[model samples]
Target: MRAMAYETYGGTEVLRETRLPLPKVAPGEVLVKVRCAGVNPVDWKIMAGGLDSLMDVVHPVVPSWDVSGTVERLGIDVPEFAVGDEVMAYARKDYVHGGTCAEYVSVPVRALAAKPASLNWAQAAGLPLAGLTAYQLLTRLGTTADDTVLVHGAAGGVGSLGVQLARAQGARVIGTASPRNHDRLRGFGCEPVTYGDGLTERVRALAPDGVTVVADFVGGVLDTTLAVLAEGGRHASIADHTVLGAGGQWMWVRPDSEDLSTLGRLADQGRLTVDVAAMFPLSELAAAFTLSQEGHASGKIVIEV
Candidate 1:
């Protein structure tokens, strides 16, 4: 199997396309033939040794953690899935067998869910990590139908889905994005506020009563979000939490098949939309990582294997 990997963590240049042995299916695991792999900020972060402290406590690693693929083989103990099942998964980041950057990946059955039939592999590939993050954060914040929730970075992978999901639950949604994406966010049923100077004031002018929950994907204005929250209101973030203050919890999403299944249903019903900004062949993964890191994407970038 051909995989892009680095023996030592450094930068994208350290990533090389090389032939490696195919991973063996373990108990309770399935081997998937990769169709499309999602590129995330964490992938590049690991590549650059950003998690060196955590890695030192664990193992130096291969990067990617999310994949949309078909099962080619199943382990003896994996009864939930069979060969040829199209699935999407958020693989455990600590796997020694490497990640979905390769032609094949082995993941636990609990981490896999049936892919939405309406979506292509590239679109399905983009959902797991970002979708799971959004799902977990919104649910953790106890978002309700009557709640008016504000989402920062509302045009981003996680933020985009967060806005749609919050609206689907009958919440009044407010999102922060650049002027160009105001229409897109509006299409998602959110009132879009342009992010920059006086962003909080702009949002306040739109919703004078105050927001019930703040899901901050960008950590740019944690203080401002806190200021705009109604009393007893919750705040959650998937990115930085250092400035989150003492009021609400910082959220780190854990992969769950249950959450993935829920997202799959939303996709299947056409209630959720995945905007894929670009697609690259697996061989061009380095360039894909570069594009994703540049932070100008309107949607998720995928690597087709």
Candidate 2:
């Protein structure tokens, strides 16, 4: 199989196309023929050793966790999927080897979900990690019809989905993004506010009673979050752990087939959609990673295998 792998923890220059043997499918796992892969900041950050202390990495590590593909074969004890099933998975394992950047990936059945019928390969690939993060966090916060939600980084991959998910629950959504993206956010029922200076004040102007939940997708907004939350309001961050010390949850997205599958259902219903900013070929994974590392793409960056 052909895969772009990094020999060491370093820059995009470290990634190179290489040939490797097929990944061994373990019990309860399925071997997928990769059709598309989603690239997130964590993909390149891990390549640069950002997660070295947290996860053990093997030599020549493959770099994507988000996969959309077809099942080629099923592993022993795996009964939930069949050959030729179209699926998408947040394929993070007990460790980070056998990623989706390769021609084939072995994903655990527990991480598998049927792809959203309305989405094409690149769009489906873009949904797993970001959509899961948004869905899980909003669920944890207990957002409801009566609540008003404020989302930091509203135009971002996760934040964009968060806005839709919150609005689906009948919550009034307020999101922070550049002025350019404000209109995009508004298209999906979010009231968009510009980020940076006076964010709390801007949010307050929209929700005078204070927000019922604050979701931080961008770091360095703890002050704004704290300032805007109403009494008994909940808060969480995927970007900042400091929120934990301030009575907010620090969430890391998990691979739950149930949650991923629900996201697919939402997409199929037209209540949710993926926003893809760019697509790269498998050979140009380095360029894809470079774009993600730069932190400026508002939508998901996908790799077409």
Candidate 3:
């Protein structure tokens, strides 16, 4: 199978297209013929050894966790899906290896969900990791209709979904982004606020009583988050671990079939949508990684296999 991989931790310069044997399917796993792979900031982060302490890296690592594909084969005891079923997964394993950037990837059955019919291959591929991160954060914070939710980095992949999911819960949503993305947030019924320089004042103008919940997708915003949060409010961050020291949850997204399925249903019901910022062919994985590292994309980046 043709794939792009890096044998050592480095930047896009280390990524090269190479031929690799098809991944072996373990019990309770399924081999998926990759249709599209979603590229997240974490993909590039992992490529550069950003997660060296948290995950073990295997040589020649293929570096994406989000996949939308069809089942080419199933392993023993996997009764949940049939061969040929279109699926999407947050395919992270205990170790860092055998990712979705290849022609084929072996995903554990526990991480698989049927792809949403309303989405194209690119959108489907984009949904799993970012969607699930937003969903889990909102769900864990117990956002309710009466709550006013503030989302940091609202124009980026995970933050975009976080705003939508919070809005879906009937919460009044406030999101932080650049002026260019303010109009985009408004389309999702979110009140837009500039993220830097007097961010607290801007958010306060919208919710004088302070926000009832804060979801931080961008790091280095804890001071602003704490300043605008209402008394007794809940908060969490996927980027900043120091939130843990301030009585906030520091979260990591997990692969759950049920959660991914709920995201699919939301997409089908028109309550959620994926915006794809760019798409690259399999051999151009390095270009995709470079784009993600640039940190300017307003939506998910995808690799079409």
Candidate 4:
């Protein structure tokens, strides 16, 4: 199998496409023929050795987490799926051998879910990490139908899905994005606010009662968000943890098959959208990593294996 891997952590330059034996499936795991893989910021963070502190958990990492593919074989103790079952999964957390970037990967059955029938492999590949992050954060914050939820970076992968999920739950959503994405946000039923000076004031003018939940995907301007939150309201972040010591949950999404199943239903029902801003072949993963690290992706970037 051909895979993009790095023996040492440093930068994208450390990544190389190499041929290696396909991974073996362990008990309760399924071997998948990967069709598409989703790229996230954490992939680059680990690549740059920024996550070395967690090295005990994550090691020579293959660098991708989300995969959309077909189950080619099932390991012992796995009963729910058989060979040729089309599925999507957020592979287990192992910085070193979480091998979604290759043509085949072995993922635990608990981390795998049936892919949405309505979506293509690329679209399904984009959902696991981003969609689950948005889903878990909103649910953990105790969001209710009457609440107004504000999502920072609403045009990016997780933010875009978060905006739609908030609306689907009947909450009023105010999403921060550039002027160009205002229409896109509006289409998702979000009140688009430009991110910059007086952003809190602008949001306040739109929702005078103040936001009931602030889910920050961008670490910057969290103080502004806190100022605009209604009393007793919750604030959660998946990106920044600098102010977590003050209060509120700083979340890191873990692999959850249940969450992926829920997201799949939403996508199948046309209630959630998986936005893929660009797609690169597995061979061009280096360029994809460069773009993802630059922090300007409008949506998820995927690699077709």
Candidate 4 lDDT, 1-305, residue by residue in tens: 88988888788888888887888888989999999999998888878877778754334567789999999998999888989999999895544565699999999988999999999999999999999999999999988898999999999999999999999999999999999999989999999999998897899998887899999988876788788899888999987786587577899888898989999999999999898999999999999999998878888999999
Pick the winner on lDDT between candidates 2 and 3: 3
Q: Write the per-residue lDDT of candidate 2 for residues 40-75, one digit (tens) a residue.
A: 989888988899899888887999999999999999
For all candidates, what are the clash counts? Answer: 0, 0, 0, 3
Q: List the residue pairs that clash in candidate 4.
A: 58-95, 59-96, 61-96
Overall lDDT per candidate, in order of appearance? 0.87, 0.93, 0.95, 0.89
lDDT for each residue of candidate 3 in 1-305, tens digit (9 for 90 to 100): 99988899988999989999999999999999999999999999998999999999888899899999999999999989999999999999999989999999999998999999999999999999999999999999999999999999999999999999999999999999999999999999999998778899999998999999999999999999999999999999999999999989999999999999999999999999999999999988988888998899999999999
Best by lDDT: 3
Q: Estimate the TM-score of every prediction.
A: 0.96, 0.99, 0.99, 0.97
> Over 4 Å off in model 3, which ranges?
none
**Candidate 4: C-alpha lDDT:** 0.89
lDDT against true structure, model 2: 0.93
Write one digit per residue (lDDT tens) for candidate 1, span 58-136: 2334458889999999898777988999999998644333789899988888889999999899999999999999988
Error of 1 at 167 (Å): 0.9
Better of 1 and 4 by TM-score: 4
